[model samples]
Target: MGAMAAAYGPLLPYLMRRFAIGVSVAGLVFGVHFAGGLLGVTASMLSLGRLTSRVAVSGALGLMAIGCIGVALALSWLVMLAGVFLIGIGFGALDLRINQMLAYSVNPKRVALLNGLNGVFGIGAVAAPILVSIAGARYGLIYAGGAAVAAVALLGFRGVPGRLRGASSSGTAPSSRRTARLVVIFATAFGLYVGVEIGVAGWMPTHLHSAGFGLAAAATLTSGFWLALAAGRFLVAPLTLRVSDSAIVLGGTAVAVLCLAGALIAPFAPVAYIATGLAIAPVFPTGVAWLATLNPANPGATSWLFPASMVGGALIPSAIGLVIARVGAGWVPTILAAVAIGTLAAFAAAARS
Candidate 1:
């Protein structure tokens, strides 16, 4: 989400002006980033045997940092698009490697909390807009762009030692085919969850504004959604210890579905927005925790699943953009409702499997 905020936050309006693109086109640009993520996931998988987890992750972060620099320096639309793709590749690799490390290295008792901490990404997402807005307003876009590049570079270096330890574990490997299949399924579920989460957060401002919300109100509503999502993950940590993962997921999905529907029917913008946030809160980290359980021996499998989910994360929002273009932005919440329901179904299927 940090990557997302850094990639799209201030850049959205700027890209719109520079490229003469509409919301849908902007969504497509985001989609380009996801497409690169898809490539990165595939690349990581292919190089699984050749590269240590640390090397892969560091390479990914370098790619992301380079992409950020590219975005900062981009003079044309094509250059911007290329930068976005590189960012995707970097993001995918980083996500995959980190998840792999977490799944393998963390004690089972603490895994859920660690997963919840991943909500830091949402914090980053939340901060990006404000930071970029402030920086762009004060120092101009160049400064804002440089900040993002520096952030990626710094984080990438900091994360290297952990990734190496994760990949170097001496556990027996799971069957490659089985791990791959599980990763695919896990990715699908996560992808759908991310798609819905991002879709709602990305479009909420417009959705609320159209419903008569003022700009401040709309921004607050959007922030509420992410805050709730971040908080929910933290809250669920202890709860997961007392109850089964499947039950928690099942209950969360049900609440999410009901809340999403409530958002669709809500007459007041604040009610709808708050409901939407509450609905999406538990879906993401819970999904990650579930995937982390799939392979005790091969934590690197989580790397594959993480990136896959991110690809979904990137794609579904793009799909929502297309839907908005074809239908209208006002319909975004309803579309998000559908995604919530679909994720519930995916979780159910995975549980059954």
Candidate 2:
């Protein structure tokens, strides 16, 4: 999340200023980023049979670090676009491999908790804007903020374990066709959910600012969305133990729709902005937990779902960006609301399956 949010958050505003682009173009940038991830996912799946899990993960992280540096240093919009694509590819590979590790490495009872811990990305998402806003305020766009994030990611790469490397050499025997179909279903649901969540979170600060809030105020609102998302994921483990996963998912989706609707239609900025966070809280971790339950044998299923969702995360915002350019920024939330409805549909399908 830090890598993604760090690369994109300031990068969004920077791209807009540099290219004289609109929100749609900004969304397209994200789309291209996810397109990179799609490529990464395809690559990882194909290579899983050939490479050890550790090598795949390490390679992915290495690519991400390189991509981060590229984003930080790029001189032109086209270069930045290419850099973001590399970032996507790296993130997708790391995401898939790490998830594969988690699914295979731990006990079934702990999978949900492990998944919730992944919600730390939301924490990073909450921080990305503040970091960019503060840095951009002082050092100018190109020199300070994103560069610092890249440096940190490079340093952090050292902490990744050696055991996770080359673990996939164990190889795959034939699995049930039903299992593959289930993975596809879950992946599609995840794709839609991610698209809506990231699209809204990615674009919300700008949307709120345009709606008449100050940058500080808008950042606070964006933080609320991520904080709530993180908090929701932390809560999901206990909640799942009590209620059915389907009930929680369906109820969360219902609340999300209402929150998004309130954000879209409400006349008052404070009410609408707060509604955005309140509505989005349950999505990421809850979605992962749902998938984990469906296939206890493979934790990678959750990882696969995450990237698939990220594909949506990349695409939906681009779609919203297109809408913003043509229709107006006010229409972005309406687009978000529609995506929320689609997420609800995805959840329903998941529940049925």
Candidate 3:
């Protein structure tokens, strides 16, 4: 779902051209998806009481498969936006459920386990560009393939016994002023995280292309960005056991800020993008770990996190689009730098939690 959420980036240039839209409208494409995603996440929170995790996961996957095919064959702006919206819902629900499974594990699913799951997500993100680069001209193939995978996964999910399947918490919920504060802090940080992370993934191809790189070159740079993201997850997973998770997050965001600074200067180069991804990788898992560790009774609390991140996904990219529309692509770094600062703010607030 993370991969599908971000897979639209390299295709943005094409989607803009194919649909008769501008940069600002291009960003709105993601906004609608996040809107639906927010709804879906909210629904999952409610549905937890009524459904098995396997049923919820399966339903989400089916929705995603249909949504992908819808986007792949869309003929109008309304249709495309609808497809994106459905995709958002499915992605949001499935991921929220997955996080519930991981975060609330008896083993607690921390350190290496958490990193492995996260690294696979990064790899999925990496695969998006490669799929796009291979058949970008006929981009529906990517969506079609995604739909197929979702279908297969949907089938595989049925094998799980109801016993091992995911379950919703029926315990008395934790609703305190401090809990609210922690939720706000974590949600804020996650929003910024998605803003920069998905924002960069969504726009990097166009960013490079605007800076005079060819289509293929831009796609490769985009792939490199995701590759670095995967690398960071795999490499940092082990180190989390040694260094404190909070330190990793703080240092990670700080380095990410510097990398964005580098990107501001070398706007066209892939190296800066790669470094930015590498620096950005550890923040999410560690933040979630920290959040879940502190608030176990509300382990499902982060059921809203993916949706919150999707909000960031929508607004941040849209803000960048506004900049690209009103000012110029050169000014994009300013927005990115501001986002990095926002990320730092999240880290500071998260530490307090």
Candidate 4:
């Protein structure tokens, strides 16, 4: 999932060259891909009772492999989009099911495990840009490799059980009105966070290139950004033992805002963006654990978060693209800083709710 998603960072230039498209058209890649993600999450939610994890996870992997092949062989821009949408579907469904299963598990170490899981995602994300750089115009090779990886991952799921038992909790369900409020607030927060994350990952390379950095250096810096994110997740797992999840999230977001602000300087851009990754690493998983703690009765509390994230992933990056079209890519970090502020506000609202 990380490799497939992060490939867009370095792949954007090749895509524009191949399709003879501008930033605006290139922006649709993230939109169409994440639109499919929303559908996948919705489908998985709807199929909870009907489909088993073994079936759902396996089917998703199958779709991912098929989608990657579709992308690799696409002859036209539209066909490539169709392929990306398919990949999004598989990515969304797989992401939701895994997170849902972990959220409902009885394991006491689930929060740390969630961080570890996403850390692995960071690993793949860290590798993708380097691979894309090496592949160059043969960008299709990256997608083909993603397909191969998905195919191999299928074998590992054979032992996964069909049904997951929801962990037992003693908290009473909140009033409907309060519950709805919490949902809206957290949804907004998740949406904003995801938007910021994807927006940075998708646009930072281009931003750096526009700022006069070489493409290869930009790609390496992008990988470094993901490396920081991956490392932060592993480093923060132990902190969960002593720090409150809410505090961790608040502190992380605050620091991320500062890092993004610092990124506005050309000389500090790479370092600042990489620092931003570390700052925001704990927000998503820790937010999940925090939400679960707040609303224990609903094992599906985190379900809303998945679709919200997909919405963020879809809308924010495209929105950034639009901004780039109008102003220029150098403003990328400024735009992201503004989005991070919105994210901070949303999380604050969630805290009150």
Tens digit of lDDT per residue, candidate 3, span 174-290? 367887777888888889988998778877777777788888778878888888888898899888878887898889888887777777665435787789899988888777777
TM-score of each: 0.83, 0.84, 0.93, 0.96
Order by TM-score, highest first? 4, 3, 2, 1
- Over the stretch 1-353, how does candidate 1's per-residue lDDT look in tens digits? 36354336234555677678787787766678778887887677566656776677778867776776777677778888887788888777666655555555557655576546666766665655455445442323543454476565656564455333334434324458877776666667777887776677677766776677654456555666666666666767777778777777777877877777776653764566566565566566666666667666565566556565667767888888778888886787788888878888888877887
* Predictions in order: lDDT: 0.66, 0.65, 0.78, 0.87
RMSD (CA, Å), each prediction: 3.6, 3.5, 2.2, 2.6
By lDDT, the best candidate is 4
Considering only N, C-alpha and C atoms within 3 Å, which residue pairs clash in candidate 1? none
Model 4: lDDT of residue 334: 91
Cand. 1 TM to true fold:
0.83
* lDDT string, candidate 2, 196-306, tens digits: 677667777767777887766666666666666666667665665677767876787778777776776535644654555545555555566566566655444554675
lDDT of 4: 0.87
The top-ranked prediction according to TM-score is 4
Model 4, which residues run further than 4 Å from truth? Answer: 167-175
Worst ten in a row by lDDT for model 3 = 160-169
Ranking by lDDT: 4, 3, 1, 2
Extract clashing residue pairs from model 4: none
- True-vs-predicted CA distance for residue 116, candidate 4, Å: 0.3
